[model samples]
Target: MKLTIYFDGQFYAGLVEIETSDCYYAYRHLFGKEPKNEEVLYFVNHELLGLIENKSGSATRSSEVKQRPINPKRLQRLAAKESQKTSLSTKAELALKQSYEEKKKKKQMNKREFMEQQKTHKRQLKIMKRKAKHKGR
Candidate 1:
């Protein structure tokens, strides 16, 4: 698991990446202002897991194989390189897009079902009114 926090024009955001077995999952969280260390720590300690389970659905398959343990000096250099880069990862971006599309599809389906129910309700009311008219009420 890795978490990258960066300023995203309008607000500060954190992108979390998790890899398990062969599947990759990513989640984004927005902080309206720059978050303090304490706040970030609290979120990670308390809410992170629940958010992951609730919001994560689709997983992107990664093709790269895991590497063997690196030399201490080489690992330090790699960490420095990573710190200098602030852009979000492409895999994370793709995961976010897929999640958005899934939500949109669900919203449209619910709207269609609601409209169908309303139509049936109106038809039932009309039938009752016609029956009352015929009985001279």
Candidate 2:
């Protein structure tokens, strides 16, 4: 959703449904400050412009308030940066945890199997050392 601030003497009128809004700077007198992003100045008509101030209070004045849809990719990126923050999403986190557990399960071996693997590894190292020692001669 895009927002625009209205300017006076531009030969435009207010919207029943705002086709566009602008930054006329005249509404600051009513708002007592300059408008910020996502803020709006609506024309009651071409002659009268008023600022739509967002109240900090919890109660919404209108149910028609607009909101953008949540972006899954954006949430994933944020989740990657701060895992502990929760990102209000669990898909990536749970997927990572499941994969970690599965990997650990695959790598585990019985004590005897581990010992046999170590013995084979040592034998291979011994053969390599013997070959290297002979190469100099």
Candidate 3:
């Protein structure tokens, strides 16, 4: 399960298996961007090193691809600012979208439950009416 990855003229140690498949997928999905299998392996290896070994140095491809220094703090702040520059209703819009999805799911569940209850009620009623008819005969 261990793999050796090459980065910055060095090979870093990495693990293939994790407690969850999501971890594997997330690592692959992040670095799989048109990368060769070898590159993906290397990327994951170096990524793990950056994470466990160096917080500031842990950025995966930013170092190899960007060819320039990218401050993580500055990038995060820029992203937040861009999101805020949208209309004042952006938060409301996001909330409404989430609620709409929840409403749809809830409505579907209610419909299914209602139908099930109706079927059970009809079955019970039929059983009672049959019993009454048989007793009167």
Candidate 4:
């Protein structure tokens, strides 16, 4: 797992990436203001896992073969290179977009079902009113 925190025009945000055997998961969290080290540490320690479990809906699959552990110096260099990049990873962006689309589709389906239910309820009420009118005549 890796967390990248950066200032995003208006607010500070963190992008978390978790890579498993064949799947990759990404989650974004908005911190609003620049977070202090302690705050970031607290979030990682206390809230990160729960948030991942609850909100992580989509995972992207990668076909890359696993490699042996890297040398310490090479790992340090790679970390430095990553720190220089200010934007989120493309894979993370795609995963987030997919999750958003899934949520939107689910919401639309729920709304349609609710509207159908309301229509049926109104029709039932109308039939009852008509029956009462016929009885009065």
Top-lDDT structure, candidate number: 4
Global lDDT scores for all candidate models = 0.86, 0.49, 0.57, 0.88
As a whole number from 0 to 100, the lDDT of residue 10 in candidate 2 is 34
TM-score of each: 0.46, 0.21, 0.34, 0.46
Model 1 lDDT, residue 22, Cα: 80
Model 3 regions more than 4 Å off: 1-89
Off by over 4 Å in 2: 1-109
lDDT of 3 at 96: 89
User: How does candidate 2 score on lDDT?
Assistant: 0.49
lDDT of 2 at 52: 38
Clashes of 1: 0
Collision pairs in model 1: none
Q: Model 3's lDDT to the true fold? A: 0.57
Q: Show where candidate 1 strays beyond 4 Å.
A: 55-58, 64-137
**Candidate 4 wrongly placed segments (more than 4 Å):** 55-57, 64-137
Collision count for each candidate, in order? 0, 7, 0, 0
Q: Write the per-residue lDDT of candidate 1 for residues 1-137, one digit (tens) a residue.
A: 89899888879998888888887788888877989999899879987899788956456776654568989999899999999987655788978988999999999999999999999999999999999999999
Give a tens-digit lDDT track for model 2, residues 13-85: 2222221233222122222244443233332323232233432212332334555887999988988888766
